[model samples]
Structure formats: structure tokens, C-alpha cells
Target: MIIRNLADRNKKGADTEVVDGQQRLTTIYEFTQGGFSINDELSKRIVRDNSDSYEFDIANNAGKETEAIKFYKKFKKGQKVSLTYGTLSSLMKADFDSYNMALTYISHHDDNVIAEYFRFVQNQERLRAGEIINSIPDSLLEQYLMQVDSKSLLFKLSWEDKRKEFDKLFYAAIGIFDEKLPLGGVDSDIIEYVKNSAGIAGRALERTNLLITQLQALSKDETWNFSSGINKRFVKFLCMLCGYGYVDFSKNPKEKLQQLFVVNKKLSAFSSAKATALSNEFVGYTEEQIENYRLIALISKGSQKWDMVEERMRLLAVLMNEVKI
Candidate 1:
């Protein structure tokens, strides 16, 4: 028997459907379940000597009282005839475990599996998160969104477009820093922000992209994968980048983005004691800056909560535009 797995099939929303050998398999299964009697054409001959045995009683031989009562009512009293195939021992003698079926499974994916294809393949027929985000119509924030090319070094870090990583990040950033709302954002929030956020989000993204581009160029880790939930090495930069609008950078942070590194190592890996101190003891930084770094560590612990997001972003924003090259 061959079975097909269909994803878009319309037959009662079934994920699987029969492809071949259904009639023969169904007949065999019925026979194994003591369903139908074998005609003389199927059997060699009738067992005439044991014709009176209950084993020859095909109608009620399935141990079904209802079928026996039905056959009794249909015929005259004690006139039911018992018939069995030649040398057939009994009626109920089937072992379900003795049968094993060989399956030849077929599906639409059989044709889709490119066994000898290239090193990489982008299936355009299936839309990815990046594609879905791009497909969104003109929105206020989308119009001001950063344009990261597919061929860019940053794009290469993610390799294949992860499902909704960028969408979540973009919406979360806008909702936190730009909207200044306590609620987290989703893809639809892109349009909502424009409808509601006066002009804050539009300006936030426009300015944030510039700083993002700067950090991308100055970062030492080539594969600084910043996508949500995985290798979020630079999320703090986003949380703090918007704060640059309220602060002055003429102070020329006594810190440095050594070897083209951008965010301070202490901020990147927080609260990890010596394991995270990037430039040795937050050295050369003033007491106010040191407090901000430690304060960020405390706030980041609860940053996933909506009420804490704005505060976290506000604190982290002070940390940006201070990476002295």
C-alpha cells in the first residue's frame, strides 16, 4: 500500500490520504476481522462431514448475538444451515500480530528534496520572516526602517532568514524606545505605531539605524549575530542608542572600542563578575558611568516585563555614543 502526505489537500482537512491498494487491503482487513464468508469459488469445497458443527455456521460464527438473533428471525425455527470451506478448522482464528504491512510512502516533498543541489538554496515559494516583513505595505515606521541588504555582512550572520527574529526585534525596539508604551509589540504594531505615536517612532528608527550602521562597522566580532533569543550580543546597544538624543558626547568617553569593538564588553555580558569586565574594572570611567553600567545590569534582569522595558532602554541609551574609537 502507498500513502500520501498532503499539506494543502482539501479533503476534509486530512493530512494523509490513501493513494493505492485500498480495495485489496480493505478486503483483506475485513476478512482478517471475520467479516465475510468465503464462497465456493474462493474455497476448494464445502466441508460436508462437519457441516453440522458451529464452526460451519458462517452467519452467527463471529460470536455476535445481534447477528445470530437477526439470522434466527429471518429464517424458520432451527432451519439455519451451517456451511464451512473444505477442511476449515474454525471461524475465529486470526492473529493480528502475525501480519506486517510494508509501506511505500509518497508525498509532495519527494519532488522538493534536491539531493544534488548547490551549497545553499532559498525557496522563494515559501515566504520567510524577512520577506513577510518586506511584504508589509507602506507604514510610517516601515518607511523609516533601516535598509539592510541581503548581500550585506550583517545579513550573512543570520544565513537563512530566521522565522520572525527580525520582526520581533524591530517591533520590540519601536514599542519600547519610540512608542514609550508598556506593551510589547508585534508585526501589526508597525502600522499601529505610525497611527498613534505622533512622530516619536519615526524619528527613533531614523536615528537608530544610523547608530546601528556605525556599530556594525565598529564591532570586532565579525559574526555579531544580534537576532533575538540567539547570540543577542548587541541588544543593549539598541536599548541605549536612542538615549544619545538627550545626552552630549563631547566628553569623549575615557573608554574605547578596542580593535574595532563597539559596545563595552561589560555591558554586553552583564553581572558575570570578572568573566564580563571588558576593559578591566570599568577603569577610567567616572562614578556616574559606573553606576549606569551596574544599574543597567539590574534593570535588564526584568527587561522582558513591559513595565521595565522603557526604564531599561532609557538606562542603556546613556551607554551608547560613548564608545571612544
Candidate 2:
């Protein structure tokens, strides 16, 4: 049976509607009105049937009251049936068992997994906060805004993009320090610096916006698609590199963006042509390389990986050295 919105009868607004199976509904209604008659043998068999193998319940037999049987048939399938008495109260609640289950799962996962999950939760919080901030009045923002268009502008980070950033920071920190931290993603001083900040998520979004703005200002070339595939990943890596001081964004913004286009172009080709080779070659390299290689391997193996993030970041590190700042 299908349920639909009833026409606004009396202009009071509809509570519900039955979009299909009206004949069946009428038959059932008549059956209830007829007092649900059945043969005495069938009634005796139905009441006695208690086998678990049976699909339907036999307890609602011909002997049951018509009103009770009619009430019993109220619960139909689908969301339409459930909306008969919609409550505004919360339907879901977080409990200790869920927390414990998450904790248990995290305990078994590697540092990369932990870091990725942590960033995911943080990004969700950031998204909710961004929504609230965006809902606020522009006048209020103007009265209290400190940074340059920071409140007005916000960046969207997907789970994959955020994970890529986490991996980049993890590896870059390790490479810079030449020593592995206690936890690959979280124990780095660089990560700690960002973590201690008041607006860590906001800062990431702002920097990303800055990168996109600068890149767009450099050229209007539509040769590369920056919204999806490898091009977007390349842009994200450049943003991270600039954030980490690897790429001098201020020195030659135009030149850097041009380099990005070239590198992204090459990376795109390599991804399509030699994905497996790319994954294999990057093996036993830096943490960043290895992490990215794993992502490439996942892609090569036909797994639906997140947003070409690893491949793009890996290419950024590779091509950055060749491209003059």
C-alpha cells in the first residue's frame, strides 16, 4: 500500500492519503465489519499454530474482536504509515554502548584511520558551525568580524579532502622532523599547533578559499576541470603546500598557478595511464607517498576511493620540486 498527502479538505491541511490499493483497503474494512468469519476448523488450527517457520502471526484469528483486529492492521509498510502520528521529539539518542563500540573499533584501527575519523567528526562539527555562522546577520558580522571576509566566506571539506590534509600534515611533519612521532597523524607538532588554535577548521576553509581565489585570479583557463577528478585534488594539495610554506604563494602567485596546471595535467594523464605503476613506484617512500600509494592501489583495485585525494597530493610533492616557485 502507498500513502500520500491527503488533499487539504476544509482547508485545514491534510494528515494523510492512500495513494494505492484502495480496493484492498475496502475489502479489509468490510472484513472487519463482517466480524472476521472463518471455518471452526481453520480458527482452531490458527489458534494452535505456533511454529516459528511460519511468516505471519496466527494469533489474530477469526475469534479476535473486529475492533482489535482492525487496530492491529493499522501498521502498514513504509514511511507514510509511520507518519500517522509524527512526534517532534528526538528519535535517536547517543548512549554509552555506542560510544564503547566506537572506542573498541578505533582501538583496532591504525593511526591513519584514527586521524581520518577524528578529522571527519571535527569537519561535521565545523559544517554545523558554519551553517550557524552563515545564518547570522551580515550586520552583526560586520560589527564583530576580525579577519578578512573570514566570517562571510567558508570552505566545504569532504571526508576525503580532510583525510588528505591530515595525511599531508602527518607526512610533512615526519619529513621535516626526520623522526616519526608517537602517533603518525596526531603526535606532530605542526598538527598540534593547528589543533590548539581557536578556529582550526575555519582556518583550513579560509586558506582553501584563498588558494582558489588566487588560482582563479591567475588565469581563466578552462582546460582543466577543478571541481572533480584529479584537478580538484591538485588544487587542494597546492593549498596545503602553501599553508605549510612549501610553495611560496606570495612570491609568484601566477607562476605557481601555471605550474599547478601543468603538474595537474601530467598527474591526470599518469593516473589514467599508469595507476598501478604509480602505486608500485611510490611504495617504501615517505609516509605521504606510501599513504597516497595505498590510495592509488585502492583505485587500481577497483575500490571506490575518496576524491583522488591521495594521488593528487602525491603528485604535488613529486612535481613541486621540478616546478620553480
Candidate 3:
């Protein structure tokens, strides 16, 4: 369907008209613009005859003159146009109403999806004590705002561009920490631990600030190198290990992150040691072994019970170690 509106170029008054039927005006407009083809002769006749019948000739022709001329030449064999033209003003009001109705129908159908997206965007803001919180601290309820903001690292990390790598780091950190400390209850310490480790509060912010400084120290290419690919994995792993995992450096806050690099070195060593073992056991192994490796990796260092985590880790370690032989 198509509708065409005729309007005066000067914004003097309501000099607008609907040159064609409101239901079909858009379709006719599209057809005129070559977006669609009018295959039916009767529809073509209606379009050609309606313009002259209404005497509708305002500017913004919508290709009507050229289209009408083409249709007449092709179909009517150059017959004189026989439609009446109407005032552009009345046609415009009908066109506006029809367009609004179409939009209303579409919005009704998409209301749920629109609402969900809106909620997701709103949730990005931190909340505190039944109030929406802004990004800045110390506005009204500072302490509660800070607490909520600290806990929101998980959400932020989930949406990171390098999400999968962050997920692996998070799972691994939680796995290691849970094995050692065993989160028994939701206490202030647990909350503080999560906030501190995730770099959402206190020492975490300092650490992040330092990391950013170091990044700024490097050249653009070097900075890009650190941010890309497996480097991101390394960085996230370092953060997780230092923040939550089991690695005891001295009480010096500055050295805590250094300890994480040491743990990553250990993990690298472990991975290297297992690389040969993984090759031999899967000598004629199909892709299924590789698939199993990924599944096994998930449970290898997660919040599983000690026995389950150890078993999975042992199995993966063995598989990886025997791959070469």
C-alpha cells in the first residue's frame, strides 16, 4: 500500500494533501521510487487516475509526474490524464493519521523487547538502598553506593569485550580461592574480599590505577600489544590471581600483584609440563578428545567440591601431559 502527501515548500500554513488512498499511499510511493513493482493493471490504473481526479499538484511530487507519465505512455498509449487534483492540506492530515496508526501497531507488537532493553541499560547504573545511584561517590548515600558499585564488577566484567577470557580468569580464581578458604557465609569480609579482589574498591582501585599508569608508560603499539589476544588473558589472569587466588606475598599491598605474576608463571610451567603428556594419550584421538578437554577445563579449577575439583584437574593435567607420547 502507498500514500502520497502534497505540501507547499513555504511553511506558511497547512497546505498539505493526501494525493492517494491513505492505505496504499506508502506502497505507491515505494513503487514510484522503484523500490517495488506494480504488477496489477487495476492498481496501476487507480494510481494513475486518482491524482488527476483529485487535482493534487503540490511540490514534493514523490516522482509522481515522471511515474504517471511513464505509466500513461506504457499502458494508456498517451491518453490525456483524467484524474482530479485535491487541496494538499486535507490529504496531509489523513496521511499523518495513517502513519501514526501504523507506528502504534508496530510499537504494540515490540513493547516487550523494547522494555527489556531499557531495563538492561538502566541496570548498568549502580543502585543503593532503594535509590538509583550515579557513578560519582559521596552524593547522598556514599557508603551504600560504594558497596553496590563494588559488587557490580561481575556485571561489568560479563559485558567486557574480552568476556570469555575474563570468565576463565574469574572461574579459575574462584575455584582456587574456594578450595583454600571455602566461602561459608556472606559476611562483610567476604563482601570486602570480592570487592577488593575484583578491583571494585579499596586496594583494587589502587592496583588498577597503577596498571593504567604502566599502560600509559608504553608506546601505542606496545599498549595495543598488551590489550590484544592472549595478552588480555594474561592480564585478567593476573588480576584474578592477585585479587582472589592463593598466592602469599608479604603484607605489602604493592607486592601483592607481583605475587600474581609469579603464580601465572607457575601456571605456565604447569601447562608446559602437561603439553607433552597430552600428545601421547591422544595419539589417535579424534576431535572428541579436544572437545572433552574444553569441558574438563571448566571444572578443573572452579567452585566444585575439593574432591571433584582435584579429580577434574588431575584428569586434565594427565591428558595434557600425555598428548605428545
Please, what's the RMSD in Å of model 2?
22.6
Error of 1 at 146 (Å): 6.8
TM-score of each: 0.34, 0.26, 0.23
Task: Quantify all predictions' global Cα lDDT against the true fold.
Answer: 0.42, 0.35, 0.34
lDDT per residue for candidate 3 within 125-225, as digits (tens), equals: 31231132111112221222233222233332233454433433433334233443221211222333443442244543443333333322221211122
Between prediction 1 and prediction 3, which has the larger TM-score? Answer: 1
lDDT tens readout by residue for model 1, 238-271: 3344333333221221232231124345654333
**Residue ranges of candidate 1 with Cα displaced over 4 Å:** 1-146, 150-153, 156-163, 180-230, 239-264, 268-270, 273-289, 304-325
Q: Write the per-residue lDDT of candidate 2 for residues 132-222, one digit (tens) a residue.
A: 3221122212221232222112121112444334333323322222222221222223333333333323543444445445333333432
Clashes of 1: 2
Candidates' RMSD to native: 24.9, 22.6, 24.9
How many residue pairs clash in each candidate at the backbone level? 2, 0, 42
* lDDT accuracy of residue 116 in candidate 3: 50
- By TM-score, the best candidate is 1
